[model samples]
Target: MRYVVQVFASAFRIRKIVNDGEFCILYSDSDPSIDCIYVTDKWILSNQAKPGGYYIAYDNGDSEYVEEDEFKMRATFVDQD
Candidate 1:
């Protein structure tokens, strides 16, 4: 698995993990006033995540699985793999 970590000129940053051509939002916090997006393999619910899709964890303990297309739109791929 490959990973890309992006840091912006802000109080937070975004980190992503790529596994087998799949992209997941590991962590992201662009605004300090809002809750950050934090998700990992352990946070994925049973059978909730699909192939090419990943979960996004919230501060309230909520999570949502988004598809690959959405991930691409939300994230910026810096390099080719």
Candidate 2:
């Protein structure tokens, strides 16, 4: 049950959930130390840094849009190696 950690332009840490055993699109990005009970049947994912910025996105059909969300890919960070 691995997870993804994204570094955005903000100072706060960003967490997002990724896929599961079935390879369904349950992707997300969140803090790395967040190890706890996931009590949701759904997943919330983040977005890639865009022209202005980035944000988190989800698809549970509970939004006022009532449609699929349009979000960018995952944001990336480079380690000094």
lDDT of 2 by residue, 2-47 (tens): 9997434311123333345543232123333333222132323222
TM-score against truth, every candidate: 0.32, 0.17
For model 1, the local distance difference test gives 0.45
Leading candidate by TM-score = 1
Give me candidate 1's TM-score against the actual structure: 0.32
Q: CA RMSD for every model?
A: 14.2, 13.9
Across 16-65, the per-residue lDDT of candidate 1 in tens digits comes to: 43343233333433334434343455544543554446444445555566
Q: Which stretches of candidate 1 lie above 4 Å from their native place?
A: 1-48, 76-81
Question: Which candidate should be chosen as best, given lDDT against the real structure?
Answer: 1
